[model samples]
Target: MDIRKATIHDIAEKLKITASTVSRALNDNPRISDATKKKVQKVAKQLNYQPNHIASALRSGKSRLIGVVVPTANRNFFSSVIRGIEEIANSLDYKVIISQSYDDYDKEVQTVEALLNARVDGIIASVGKTTENVDHFKKILRKGIPLVLFDRVTNELDVSQVVIDDYYGGFQATEHLINEGCRRIVHFSNSQNINIYKERKRGYEDALIKHGIPVDPNLIVFSKLQLEDGRESMQQILDSKIPFDAVFSSSDYSIMGAMQVLKEKGFKLPEDVKLVGFGDEPFTSFTEPTLTSVNQKSIPMGNFTAETFFEILNHKDQSNNIPRKTILKPELIIRDSSINKEKPKDQTNLEVIEK
Candidate 1:
């Protein structure tokens, strides 16, 4: 009762063909005839033969594997993005290996290093919040491995990237609140060090200025934009006695935290404190009152990131040429959270803007 794994040699022996012919047929090599290919494939399937990817990669110098790095998969945005990446990679006969950084800088560096050590053909990544120095990413470029950044990216590295127009999203979110008659709108920001956060903050300020409202420095609260950070920021705003009628949070989690505080404190949403959040997390719609948020186009961003990696791989000879920076537009989804009944302005319509 011995069991054995099937190999190309087994299929060749069973079909009375040379192993080389079987190999070429299985790989769909142009040298093999269609009849031989069909016969080899059928025999291989009958024998439960699986191609040795490692050996093939070693011979061809292509692992056909792509590595992806994200902040965390627990969030809806990152998970959805990974799904989109896999869909494209699978179609191209490439495998994907995913890693998480948990928003930690050192962890991100370690993950990238591990992927490189595994001999992945390419990499798609979203930098962590604390990632300021990109020397490790430079190492990937030095090794001539195709790398593409998505979502959280930086201009310090000269590489292809896929990112949503954070500035436009912020502007739209802030302007929507302002249109709802919110004069003193507070902003809950995560970190100004990150490019996305900085762009969003700039958009918020610009929108206020455009609407003839003086940008109040006191209304801006900076933190990690976590749940506790949101609660603490809200508490500080209450303690400071700063007059604020609306809030535009940079992340959905932070906004939920702030909303919790508002609810406990008996502040009526939209009536007392109109609020808008970024990232349009799934929970936004299911909350006590639906949240108004900006859709980051996560799935499309991921798909484009994978596509860009393949484009680079295909043009490896010219990879050192000018890099491509793809910017996608975001949509603002209006809901019960940010609308004022007295000043309603087309909540049913979805608004999209590009930068």
Candidate 2:
């Protein structure tokens, strides 16, 4: 077996052509005839010649690669967003490298460093839950790399960001529960430092105030918004002896956890306690009583994120002038969990409320 790696020179030698001609033909340069280009490509494949993209990037100062960092790829929402990002990115001839931080600050920092070292042209990220200090992200802007953030974001960094109207989503969720004859609603949220959750909590509060319902401190539960966290929050609420008529969670996972606890405690959904969740996860519809949720428009979110990234990339010189902020509208999906009245099977309760 040949231990040495094949190069353009090897392909040229085998095809009896100049190395320059081989390179031009491999790159599909118009100066090279089609027949020659095809012949060169065939020989290059036969020789297993791999182009050195790193070397090419070093010379041209462009890797033609984009990096995306998400908290986790396990959720359907994140995966859908990734798909949307890829749809636009692949069409534009740029390859995307996805990195998961698992919502860990240290891991997010390391991933950003690794992407920078790889010489990616740009980076798109959703800030992790534990990322209090954004110096690591600041380093990217200092190095003149275009960074775009989506979903989970921070106002501390002046960069382009794409997010759904979280405040509206929260308000809608709470207002829907209110309309369902729920006065005492439990709001499950996460860190207030994160803009999305903060805005959501604000919306929740505002909706209560708008409806003449006193905002109860005990009704608002802040947690990591995981399934277990939801369980703990619900148990705490139950133990506190607060008579809540509805529950609105910022995450579907947490809401699902609350549902399980409610079932265990012999509380009927909608009849006893209405429920609404954010991020219309696929499993929401498959539950015993389908869950009502806010659709964050994952597909459109991804498309806008990629578009913003490219916009920054195109205007790299002016990227620092004024940061771009794109906010998309969210949809509320109504289902059995929040509806007290009997809904028809074929009825689609998708509401796109304008804010």
Candidate 3:
């Protein structure tokens, strides 16, 4: 004997009820009684009935799915943010589809297009490092899809965004180094075209000026802020014969590379030269001389981004409800890399030597 697949019609026939009644019960429609829903659910389990979500989505005009795009999924920051997004999305019975841009502009465009093709209810993204043209994002808006950006955002697009106070993080990092007796500080920066990097650079310069330290153009280096770039920047500083006592990198990976070079050169951390980095990566606390860095509140930022998406979705039909931008504060985590072993009574008067 051959067995037939179970369907709503079969369950309804078994219970001597209408197929529409079984469908509503299975969908947990409030109009259906609790006893009816339970009976229908029990029959569905016994018959191994599976609801076709795709068909239901098409009928309801709501996929109940969200798309998320990030620069790189491997990074702790992005991963943490993704987790927060999932936490909120799952609570609302929504599923998430994630994609990585790999910091490539073309790849970002392709990813966004793919998500749009998937007919997701909304999209959350962090702009890629090389993303300059945002026409692709605008296309999503034109199609009536809700969009939200976090971290690496662009002001040109009038969309909801969540970001940390990168400027303050930079200022605090530099000021910590100054207080630790580091003068002639070297700064490893990412592309200035990115807003976060630009703000960090500004903060670093302002902190120096506030402390009456001359800003040296030679000490500032711009790169993609990769580990290799960090190594290369350090090498350039060493070869230039520029006397430097500290280094502040916009990325933890880059600063890790700089630390590798400093260690190989037999320089004692926070003694020969102090150091600090952004992102507060997990490894920062595990190194021989633990690193000092900035914590960008990545998980919270992610939660806020997802929540913003929901808000947009709720008000999508209301033209008067304007999108809002959310800004989070960053924290400076001091460690062996930037702390003075012997605390000075008054660090303010420490003399700094510059070349």
Candidate 4:
């Protein structure tokens, strides 16, 4: 037997009907009788005739694929979210094509355009730090594709969004520091433009205000989320006369960097400087002193995104009249790094000097 692409002509020849009738039967038009449709469908299946959806979508304007745009793919947080999205998408028989923005605006714009050219059915994205003007995303929306924003977002656009409450996480971390007797606390953040950082900064400020601590203008330092950036920021902070007893870094990698510098400078953890970080990446728990940080529920966020996109595709999204924002809470994991609680003395003394 020879394998060949099956077509509507095969169905017409088999059914002894005109090709037009076979086509209408295959489409299940009301004008076509049920018997004809059933017969045509059986023959089409046996012939393994697959319709070219691309051609159909060109005429009908729809696709079965979803596009995902994210910041650096190397990070644990984004990768975790992507895993969630991938799992759900795979289960639902949908394809998810992903691209990274690298936290750059122009790169983000280009990625969106390329995804559009691929004619994806919908998109889920976390805008980059430089994505202040969301007009590029807005253009994709104009083409009638549903856009969902996750993690970092732009307030200028009225699109569905899913993100963790970053401000609350910041507030929780900072307040924990003050409660533990840290007077001069500093915020070492990476990007200031994105919502995640902005909200976290606001929370940090609010915590300082509520706790009666004066917000030091010079304390909030900016640095890239890199080991070198962390080390350099620490050096600059140490060089200054302004002393900091505690640090709240927005990224775990930065927290580790600060820790390295603090260790080299001979500062004891929790005693000299209590530290906490955001985005509980894998290394957070294994580091020396075991970093205390915020768990952003990365995987759940991605899965929720995938699940939400499918709903939108199925026309079952929660709301249409008003754009809905699903904000998940970040859990604060208090580890040994920020542990100010004194450990109990070993009861070996009760042995009474055993021989």
TM-scores, each model vs. reference:
0.87, 0.93, 0.88, 0.80
- Model 4, residue 346: displacement in angstroms? 20
- lDDT score at residue 352, model 2, on the 0-100 scale: 34
Worst 10 residues of 1 by lDDT: 346-355
Best by lDDT: 2
TM-score of 1: 0.87
Residue-wise C-alpha lDDT for candidate 1, range 249-320, written one tens digit per residue: 999888998999999999999799998999999999999789999998888877888888888898859555
Q: What pairs collide in candidate 2?
A: none
Winner on TM-score between 2 and 3 is: 2
| Candidate 2: worst-modelled 10 consecutive residues by lDDT | 346-355
lDDT of 1: 0.88
Candidate 3, superposed: residue stretches over 4 Å from native: 1-22, 30-54, 316-318, 344-355
Judging by lDDT, tell me the better candidate of 2 and 3: 2
**Best prediction by TM-score:** 2
Evaluate all candidate structures by whole-model CA lDDT and list the values in order. Answer: 0.88, 0.89, 0.88, 0.82
Quote the positional error of residue 135 for candidate 4 in Å. 1.7
What is the model-wide C-alpha lDDT for candidate 4?
0.82
* Residue-by-residue lDDT tens digits, candidate 4, 1-355: 1215777888888889988898788767899999999999998888888876566567667667788998888889999999999999989777788899998889999999998887888889998877778889989778767788889888888877888888888998998888778878889886777778878888999999998999997998897767788888888889896888988988888888999999987998877888898998889879888888888888888987777677666774424534678777788888878766585311111111100
